[model samples]
Target: MIQNEIIETIETIETICSRRSVRKYTADSVSDEAVLTMLECARFAPSGLNNQPWRFIVVDDREIGRRLSELTHYSDIVASAPLLIAVFLDTDASYNRDKDLMAIGASIQNILLSAHSLGLGAVWLGEILKNKESVSKILNAPGSFELTAVVAVGHLDESDPGTAERKALDEIVFKNKY
Candidate 1:
């Protein structure tokens, strides 16, 4: 029999393992409490020199979320999600953009993992930054930060079968020097 702690950890793994993109959500509104909690989880992600260049902007306003959804081609599945967070890399934040982007990716992962643990679903959408002008005006992003990714979140409307397929272990793994 598994110890209680191990069982709990197993459950978390199961939740993460079966997680899937959920673009459809009920009419439920995401509370500020949930949003804060998710950001709190993101706060601890590793950053170069602990600079923590990632900034999370919450879009709860249906109009604003809709605007961003349309601007980024976030899709109905993503648009229907209750909340969206714009993850930014504060390039002028005493770090280079490349390092900031890596940190921002970690921060985004934190948000997604937290959502999965909470029975919510999140999808990481990239490159909306290519339309920087629109997204900047939409979110009113600060000059110091460059929008890198967006995360849409909500309670999943249906079941999650499993993770996407992975390359065979042998295909990716390498020994000593590869």
Candidate 2:
């Protein structure tokens, strides 16, 4: 049991560390099974009071994806990726506003990590929030749903997108108090 646990832990760490924001992807489409697996992982993400306020609008239509791409600077990725998932906060299901938003963020992270584990590349497009209203309208989402993020996903074109540099732990972490 311990050996299995350690192996699982190692695999999880590898997946997290190796995951990168893939802006380029192949023309091939993502499988329905793969997309559903990602969403299943997202639904299990921790939520405040277990309200589970996160809602997703999966957009696979090329025309709709193009329209959405116009709202973000990451237009190339959005327009070209085989799949797009618009994460939304269902206001009616929220408990506390701030906590629910954090929960939604966790949900989005789950989607990204799961996509990576499934050998699919995904980029979370938050800059699209500047045109949140327009995005909502395009997706025909309910008024109660607030746009949180748009993730572009597909089979990666690049073999390795490469890792980004990060600040040392000591620079960001504090023992007790800052």
Candidate 3:
């Protein structure tokens, strides 16, 4: 019963599931159009009470990207990517901080899915997360929004990695009463 778009999205998820933390990329840039589309998808992710407390800041300027890379101690992986997304969680949302954080995490899923569907590659940049305040100032983000993480994206330099080793289903899945 899947719609064509839904089926395409499933295939996209599978492709992204094979994605690795790509550390290398050519200097080619990601188009503004692609970045726009990714943000559009992120805008639609579910949020608690529809609070939708996420603000996305896209950084594609090489100098800005380099400065952000420096401020957050991002590795070559981040520096090489043509696009960097500053995922902001609006703390002023109608929910508690935890809810805001949880909601932002869901929105990141949408970004990933959309990027994958578009044939671009992205790696979740976690180090940027540890330096939120500094990152905010560097990016000129509003004080009300908290920096959560950066998603570095670009055309990949390597092929998609195959299925990863995962825990057995029996080990993690539980029945209704478990």
On lDDT, the candidate that comes out on top is 2
Candidate 1, residue 46: CA error in Å? Answer: 0.5
Model 3, 23-55: lDDT tens digits are 556678888889989998888988878989999
* Candidates in descending lDDT order: 2, 3, 1
lDDT-better candidate, 1 vs 3: 3
Clashing pairs in 1: 23-77
For all predicted structures, in order, the TM-scores are 0.85, 0.95, 0.84
Q: How close is each model in CA RMSD to the real structure?
A: 3.1, 1.9, 3.0
Tens digits of per-residue lDDT, candidate 2, 40-123, equal 999999998899999999999999999998998889989999999999999999889999999988998999999999999998
Backbone clash numbers for all candidates listed: 1, 0, 0
Best-fitting candidate, measured by TM-score?
A: 2
Model 2 lDDT-worst window of ten: 159-168
lDDT of 1 by residue, 1-178 (tens): 5699899999888866776656566668777788888899999998889999888788877888777777765557446777889888776775666777788888888898888777777788775667867887888888877788889887776654424777776788877354
For model 3, the run of ten residues with the poorest summed lDDT: 156-165
- Tell me model 3's lDDT, rounded to 2 decimals: 0.78
Clashing pairs in 2: none
